[model samples]
Target: MTSLFPTTLFRPAAAVVAIAAALAPMVSLAAEPFVLQDIRVEGLQRTDPGTVFAALPFRVGETYTDDKAAAALRALFATGLFKDVRIEIDGKVAIVIVEERPVIQSVNFVGLKEFDKDVLIKSLRDAGIGEGLPFDKALVDRAEQEIKRQYLSRSLYGAEVVTTITPTDRNRVNVSFTMTEGDAAKIKEIRIVGTKAFGESTLKDLMDLTAGGWLTWYTKNDRYSRAKLNADLDTIRAYYLNRGYLEFAITSTQVTISPDKQDISITITVQEGQPYTVTAVRLQGEYFGREDQFRSLVTVRPGEAYQASGVAATVKAFTDLFATYGHAFARVEPRTEVDRATGQVALTLVADPQRRVYVRRIDVAGNTRTRDEVVRREFRQLESSWYDGERIKLSRDRVDRLGYFKEVAVETNEVANSPDQVDLVVNVTEKPTGNLQVGMSFSSADRLAFSASVRQDNVFGSGNYLGLELNTSKNARSLVFSTMDPYFTVDGISRSIDLFYRTSRPYNSLGDQYQISNPGGSVRFGVPFTEYDTVFFGIGLEQTNIGATAGIPNQYFDYRFRYGPRSTSLPLTIGWARDQRDSALTPTAGRYQRVNLEWSAGGDVRYLRSNLQYQQFFPIGSKLTLGLNAELGYGKGLGGRPYPVFKNFYGGGLGSVRVFEQGSLGVIDPTGAYIGGASKFNLNSELYFPVPGTGNDKSLRIFAFADMGNVWREGERLDAKSLRASAGFGLSWISPVGPLKLSWGTPLRSQPTDRIQRFQFQIGTAF
Candidate 1:
C-alpha cells in the first residue's frame, strides 16, 4: 500500500490558477478511479464536520476520481471558513484537512470619545468586520483607516488609531481599537483676494465660515471643514451674482495647515468682472396656453441690475405654476446672453412641462413614535390626485406647524414602468414632544414666583395635547389643567378643555390682604376657516370673590357691592386668529392677527370684553429684522351692570409695555393700589439684529425697541398724551430650556407717580 501526500494547500485567498496548478499534480497522481470506503474531515474546531462534508463532491462508497478530487478541493476552499485545505488518499480512503480561520469573539474600542462604541461597531459590521464572524486581518486594517478618516472629517488632523488582536479560546480572537483624538483644527485666517466691487471684509461677512472669534467656541464656525468651506464659497458666489457681477468667478482656493496641525489658513481668489444690467427679458417655451399668466410671474426686468436671485425666483415661480397644473416634472431653464462691450445681458426663461402624473400612493416614514394617521391626516395633496405644488407646500407647512417633528419633508418619486404615476413620500423626523418643567422666576409684580408644569403635545401618538400647571408667587397663585385635540373632527376642528383656579392681588406697598380669588373652567372649539385662519367659540363659568381686606381698592369694593362678594358669571367667547409668520418662536417675516370677544349675558355680572392684536415682522437684509405690534382692548358694562374688575385688562408688563412695573400702568386707587382698567392700547416697535461674532445665527439676537401704551377706566377717553412711552435695548436667546428675553428700559415719557422697573426679563415669552 502506498500513501500519497498532495503537499499542496488550497486557499480561497490565493488565485484560482495557482490553486488549480497545485492540484494538477495530485489529480495526475490519482488518475486511477477507486470506490471510496469512507471520508473523514480533520482540523475542525468551531466549524461542524457536516459543513465540510456538505461542500464535498462525493459521499462514502462513491467513486472518487482525479476530477472528483479537483472538484472537492475547489468546493471546500470556497466555504471561506477554512484558511488551508488539503486532501490525501491511501488504500481507497480519502482524508480531508482544513485549518479553520479564527472567529472574532469580541470587538471593543478604547479612548474613543469622538464616536460612540456602537457607532464604530456598526460601521465595522457594515464593512464585514464584527464579532461572531470569521476574522480577516485585511478587513481590520481597513476599519482602522476608516476610523482615522472619520476623525479627519471632524477636523481632527492629529487623530491616530491602532488595532490590536488578542487570541482567545476556541480558535477565536478579540479585537480592540485604541484611538487618540486630538483637538480640532481652528481657522486661523480667511483671506479673500482680488475683490474690487465689494470690500473684502463685507464679502467675508457674508460667509458662515470665519476665523477665530469670541463666539466661535459656541458656534464652531472657526472649525475648518471641507463641506463648510464649499458652502461658504457657494454663498460668496451667490452674493456676487446677485449684486450684478455676472462674470464673477472664484479662480482658486487654497487651504494650508500648520505643522502643529492645530491651525488652518484659507485663501480664496476671485475674479470680479464688470457688472451687467438686464437689456431685455424674454420667455420661450410651452406655457400650457397661459403665457400671459406665466409672464406675470417673471421678476427679471429690463433697465435693472442683473440679479441671480430674481432670476431664480422667476424660474421657481414658473416651475411651481406648472406643477400646480399637474406638471410634476416641470423644468425652467434660464439662459443669459452677455455683451462685453455694453455690459448688458439678455435673459431668456425656457419652461418644459414634462409628462403629467397623478400620485399613485402616499407613504410616511421615520415616524417611529408617532402614528401614521397623525401625519397622513395633515396631507392636502391626497393620493390618486393630480400633483399640486401649492397644496403640497401647504401640507408640509401644516405638518411643520404641529411642532411635533424636528423635520418634515415631501419627496416625489416616479412610479416604475408607469409614466403617468408617481408616489409622494412624507418623511418626518420626530422629536421629544413631552416636557416637564419646574422653574423659579421673579418679576416686579409676581415677585419670587415658582412654577411647575408637565405637558405632552403628542400623547401616545394621538396628536393631542395634555398639560397641568401650578404657579405660586407673592401676589398670585394658580393651578390649571388643559387638554387639546387638534383633530377633534375630520373637518379639522380642534377642541380644547381647561380647568383653572387663580388668586391675584394689586401690586402696591399694601400686603396681600387685598386679593381676588377666581376659579373657572372652559371648553373651546377651533374651526379652521382658511389655511391660515381659525375661528374659536367657547363658554366658561367663573366666580370672582373679592376679598374684603383692610386695604381694598375703592374700585373693587364698588364691584363687590354691586355684584356681591362672590359673583358667578357665564361668559361666552368668540375669537379669530390668523398666523403667517415664518416662525412662531423667532419670527423674521410675516404677519399675525387675533381678535377675541367675551360676553356675559345670563349672569349677575353682565359685561362685554373685546381684544384685538396685530403683529408683523420684516426682514432687513440678511441679519436684521424689524417687528411691529399693536393691541387694543376694551371692556364695557351691559344690562346696567359695571364691568367686572377681575376681567379688566392690565398693562405695563414684559408682554405689554416694558420699564413700568407689571400691571401698574392702569388707573390708580386713592389707597395707592394699582386698579387695572377696562380699556387699553399698546404700540411696540423693535429692530432686531444678530449678535456680533455669531455670524447669521438667529437663535441669539440683540434688539432695540420703543414701546408706548396706556390703560384707561371705562368711558374714559383714549388720549395720546396719557400713554406712557419707553425706549430700551434687550437680548433675546432661544436657549435649550426656552426663549429668554432680557431688557433694560428707560422711560421716555413718564409721570412722577409712575412705578418704574427698568431691568426686566422673562422666559417662554416671544413678541
Candidate 2:
C-alpha cells in the first residue's frame, strides 16, 4: 500500500507510522463534521489553484472530517506532482501545506559521440527524463544506464555515462548527461575446434566475420556482432547440410572479451555426424491432381547423397505450384527417417493445401522521391485478386531489378476481421540514382585520358534515364547524350534516344593514325517478348568524314577516293538479348546472350554487320567463380559493292586481345600499316578468386584469364594458325570513383612481329 504522503527515504514503514501519528490530532478533531469552511493550499509554484480545489474531498461549505483529509491526501499523492501533504483546521477553516516535486527546466548532453544528439535526446525523452517534465533521481539514473547499454550493443564495452542535476529557481531542476565512448572491441581470433570433411580455411571463407583484415575499417568485418555471428552459424549449418551431413550441429560457442575491453576472441565447437545418402524418396501431397508435373520438380533421387538444398528446392517448387492454383496458405512439410546402421535416410514430403486468400490492398512506401505508380507498375499481383506466392515474389524481384532502391521488402499483414484477406506492403529504401563524375585514367596505349559524365536513372522520379558523357583521350575525343523512358508504353515497352559526335584517330598496324569524324543519332524501342527476353529495333543516320594525315593508312585514302571525303548512310539495326544474370554490375551465376545485326542500304558503300556474344558465370566454390565470354563478329558488303574500308573491326586492346597493342591486330598493308579486319572473334575465360585480406568482400577480386582471338580481313577465311592467344592474371576493384582493372598478359601464341603490350588497364569494365 503506497502512502498518501511522502515517506522517509531510509525507512518507509517508520515514516508511515510517523505520518499516522501526526494525523492523529486531526483525526480526533474530525470526529464530528463541521460546515462553512474555507480551504487554502500553501505550496503552489506551477500547479493551478483550481486543480487543488477540485481534488479536495470537502467543498467550501461541506463537512470537514478525518476521512475527507485522508481522501484529499490520497488524491494529491496520486497526482505525482507533490511529495508532502499536511492538513490543519482552525475555526472551521482548513489549511493545506504541500511540497511539489521539481519540474525539469532543461536537459543537455555532453561528450557523446557514438550516437547523434537528437537520437539520444529522443531516447531519454521516451524514458521520462527531459525538459518540461518532473525530475526524479531514479529516472535519471536509469537513463544513464540505458545510454551505457546502447553503447555496449555497438561493441563499446568500455563506455561510461554520468548524469548530474542542479536545482533552479521556482522549484525547477536542470539535468545533464556526460558520456565517454571508448574503442570498439575488435575480434582478435576465431577458432573452429573440429572439422573433418572440409579444411578450416575453406570453412572460414564461408563466414563474413574475420579476426582482422586490411579492409576492416570499411567492411567492419573485425567487429564482433551477435547478429553477424548468428548468420555465420547459419551458413555453416547450411554448408554441412548441403554436403550430406544431415545430423551436423554446432555444439558450443564462446565469446571472450579481453580485460582491456579492446579485443575479443571467439571459439566454436562442431559435430560432423556421419554423412547420409538417400535410399529412397516418396512424395505424398495434394497437388490438385497434377502429380506428374509436381513429381518432376523433385531433384532428389534414390542412391544420391542426401542433399538438403535439393530438398528445399523441391519443397519450394511444390509450394509455388500450389500457389499457382490460388492456394495462398499452402505448406509442404518434409519428414526424414534415418537408419543409423546403414547411414541412409528415406524422405517423405507431405503437403497441406490451406484455404485461399485474397489481397485486400497493396501499399507502397519509403519512396520519398519516386511516385507510387512508378513502383506499383512493376508488381504482378493485383489488389482484390487471389494471392499468388510466385507472382508476389516476382513483383518484389522486379522492383529490386529497377536498381532505383537500395533495399526492397514485401510484407503480408492479415487484415483484422477478414480471415481470407491480407494487405501487402512493399517497402523500399531509395538510393541516389543520380551521379556526376569527373576522373582520369591511364594505360600504356591510351596514355592519360580524362572523362566526365552526368547521369540520372530516376529523373524527377518518373523512372527515366538520362546521361551526357564526354571523353578526351590521345587517339579519341567524343561527346554523347542518351535518354531512355522505360514506361513509354503501358505494356512496359522501352524507348531509347541517342545522339553523339565523335572524332577518332584510331591506331593501325603501321603505327599510323587517321582522324574519322562521325555524328549520328538513333531511336530504338525494346519490346519484351518474355520476362527475361527483349527484342530491340532501331533506325539511325550517320555522316562520316575522313581527314588525311601524314603517314596515314592507305586504306583511309582509298576509302576517301571511292566514297568521297564525306559520306552519309541510313542504318537499320535489330537486336535480341536474353539476360538472366542476378546483377547488372556484378553477376555471380547466370548466362547472358545477345545478337546484334545492323545494315545500311542507302549509302555509297552498302554493308551488313553482325555480332553475337555469350557470357556465363559459374560459381566454382564459396569464394571462387568462373566466368566465360565469347564474341563473334562479321561484316560484308551488299548490293555487289566492296566492303567499306572505314567499316572495319579492330581487336587487341583492353576490351579484346590483351597482349597486343590497341588496334594493332589483323592483315598488314604493303606499307606495313595495320588495316582492320571485317571478321573478328574472341574467347575470354576467367577464374575469379576472392582477395585474401578483404574477407568476403566481392567488390575486389583477383582473376586469371585466358584470351584467344584473331581478326580476318575482308573475304579472308579464318584460320587457326593465324589466331593469337595470351594467358595471365588481373586485379579488379569496384572503387568509389568507378570500376578499375589492371592486367599483365603473357603472349602464348603470337607472331614475332606483333606489338607486345604486356600491361593493360581500363576504367569502367568489370572484366
Candidate 3:
C-alpha cells in the first residue's frame, strides 16, 4: 500500500490546461494498478454523495488504473455540479475531493417592465442559469448579452443589463439582473434610392415600416426592427414585380442610427430593371392527361404585361389542382425565359406530380381544455383516404368556424419510409369559449338599456352552446334561454331550442301600462345543404296579451276586441342562410344572404310573413372596404283575416334609416302612437376605412353610410315618395364588452311629421 496518484486540482475555466496538468500525475500511476478497497467523496453540500458515486468508473473492490481514474474525473466534471475536481490516492483508498459550484438561491430582475419577469426567467433557465441550478460565470455573462439583444429587438438601443452575483450561506448564491431601458429608437427618415419608374413616396407607401406618423405610436411602424425592415423590403419588391418590373431587385439597404442611438435612418437601394411583357405561358412536364383542364387554370395571359403575382397564382393553382388528384407532394415551378432585346418573357409552368399518397392518420394537438373529439368531428379529411388539399383546407376552416380555438392549422407530413403515405396534423390553440357579460348601452330611442348574458360556446368541451340572455330597455324587455348542439345527428346537422318571453311598447306610446306581452318556445333543426349554406325549420307556440290603457292605439284596441284580449298562434318557420364572409366579426369581403318565412295557419291568428336580406362587402384596398345591404319584408292574411297588428315589422333607427326615430317611419295611429306596418323595405350602403390612429386594425373603423327604407301597411301601396333617406358617418369598434356602433345621421328626405333623431349608438349589435 503506497500513494500512487498525487492530488491535483482541475478547474473548468481552463479545462484544457488544467486537465493536462492533472493528467501528468495520472501517467506516473498508470503502470501501477491497485485494487480499491474503498471510495470516498468530499465537499458534499447540497448534492448527494450517491451522485458522485454513480459517475465514478470504478467501484470498491474493483481494480483501478490511470485510465479508469481519468475516466472518472471526466465523468464527474461533465455533470456540471462541481467547479473544481481533484483525486487523491492514499494506499488502498481513493479520495475524490471536489469544490461544488454554488447553487442559485434566487434569480431576480430589477426595472424589468418591457417583458414579463417569468418570461425572462424561463429564457435564462434555458440558457443554463436559474434558481436551483449550479451558477456558471460564463453562462451568466451570455445571459446578460441575450437580455440586451432582446431589448434591442424592441428598438431599445439604449438598454443596458448588469448582472450581480452575491454569495450566501450553504454554498448558495443570489443572482440579480438590473436593467436600464432608455427610450426606444425610432425611424426618423426612410428613403428609397434608385427609383425612376415610380415616385419615391408612392413606393414608400407600400411598405409597412415608415417614418414617424400620427399612428406610429400605436402601430409601432416607426420602430427600427431588422425583421420589420426585411418584411418591408419584400413588400416593396413584390410591388415592383407585380407592376411588370420583372427584373426588380433590392440591391442594398442601409440602416444607420444616430450617435445617441435615439434615431435611426433607413435607405433602400433598388435596381428597377426594364419592364417586360409576357410572350407566352406554356405548360411543361406532366399534366396527368388533363392538359386542357390545367391550361384553364393559367392566369398569366400572353398579351398582358409580366406580373409576378399572375405567375405565382398560376403555379399555386396548378399545384392545387394536382393535389386534388391525390398528389400531395406536387411541385410547380415557374421557369422564365427572358428576351432582353424584345423585353419579353416566356413563362413555363413545370409541374411534377411526384408520388400520389393517401393520409395515414390524423393527429390533433394543443387542445388542453377542449376535448379532442370536438375538433376531430369537424374534419372532413378522413384518415386512410386519398389526400385532397381542398378537403384539408375545408376541415381547417370548419374547425376555425367553431370559435372554440384561437388558431386552427392543418399540416401534412410525409410518413417516414412510406412515400405513399402522409399524416395530417391538426393543431388547435384553444381559447376561452365561455363568456359572462353584463353591459349597458344608450341610444336616442332607447335612452338607457341593460343587458346580461351567460354563454358557453363549447360547453364542457362538448361542442354544444348554452346561453341565457336578459335585456331591458325603455321600449322593449326580453328574457331568453337557448341551447344548440352543432352535431346533433353526427352528419353536420344542428339542433337548437329556445324559450323566450318578450314585452314591447311602441315608440311614442303614452305609458308602459299599454304594451304587448308575448311568451313562446321553439325547437329548430339546421340541415346543411353545402359548405356555406344551411336550411333551418322550426315550429313555435306563442300567446299574445294586449294590455288596454288610456290613449291606446286604435289598431291594437280593435285587434284585441276582435281576437279577444289574449290570442294564441301556432307558427311554422323555415329559413335559408348562406355565409361566405371572410370573418363574421369584421367582414371585409364576401357575401351573406338570408331568407325567412313564418306562417301561422292555426289558432286565432292566420297569416304569412316573409323576410329576405342580402349583404355584400368589397375590399377596395388594403385599408378600405365597401359594403351594401338590402332587406325586404312582407306579410299577408291567409284565412280572410287581417294580418296580426302585434306581428308588424318596424323600421327607422340605428339599424334602419337613421335620423328617423326608432319605429317611426310607419303609419301613425290617431292616438299619436307609432304603429308599425306589415310591409318593409330597406337598403344600406357603407364605405369603411381604418381609423386615423389605429393603422390596419379592422377592429376599429370609421364608415360613411347611406340608408333608405320605409314601412307600409299590408294593403297600402309601396310608395317611393314615402321612403325616408338619410346619409351619415359612424364609428365601429369591436370592444371588449361587445361590438359598439355610433352614428350621426342627417335626413336627406324626411316628412314633416316624422320624428327625427340625429344621433344614435348601441352595443352588442352588428349589421
**Number of residue pairs clashing in candidate 3, backbone atoms closer than 3 angstroms, sequence gap of 3 or more or interchain:** 0
**Candidate 1, which ten residues in sequence have the lowest lDDT sum?**
1-10
Q: For residues 1-767, could you state the per-residue lDDT of candidate 2 as single tens digits? A: 11211122212233443564466456435556789458778988888888787887788888777777777776665565666677877777888877887999999878877787776666566666678877767667656666676677678999988888889998899998877887989999999988999888878878888888776787778888888899999999999998789999999999999999999999989999989999888878666788788889999998988889999999999988887777777899999999988899999989888878889999998999999989999999999999998899999999999999999999988899988898999999999999999989776777899999999999999999999999998877899999999989999999999999998886654567778898999999999988889999999988899887866677778878776889888889999999998666667899999999999978665899999999999998667889989999999988887777777888886778887877788867666666779999988998988777676678888989899898998899889889999989998888876788889989999988888989888777644
On TM-score, the candidate that comes out on top is 3
Q: Any idea what lDDT model 3 has?
A: 0.86
Off by over 4 Å in 1: 1-144, 162-179, 365-372, 415-418, 430-432, 436-451, 472-476, 505-507, 511-515, 547-554, 557-562
- Residue lDDT tens for model 1, 136-186: 776677667767877888889999999999998889999999888889999
Task: Provide the RMSD of all predictions against the true structure, rounded to 1 decimal.
Answer: 7.3, 8.2, 6.8
Per-residue accuracy of model 3 over 90-203 as CA lDDT, tens digit each: 888988988899999999999988887776677666666778999888778767776787889999999999999999999899999999999999999999999999999887
In model 2, the Cα lDDT at residue 378 comes to: 94
TM-score against native, each model: 0.84, 0.78, 0.85
Q: In model 3, where do residues sit more than 4 Å from their true spots? A: 1-110, 116-143, 164-177, 367-372, 415-418, 438-452, 470-478, 502-518, 543-567, 601-605, 637-641, 670-672, 691-695
In candidate 2, position 198 carries an lDDT of: 89
For model 3, what is the error of residue 365's alpha carbon versus the real structure, in angstroms, after optimal superposition? 3.9
Give candidate 2 regions above 4 Å deviation: 1-186, 194-202, 213-220, 339-342, 358-363, 382-386, 413-423, 507-513, 667-675
Q: Deviation in angstroms for 721 in model 1?
A: 1.4
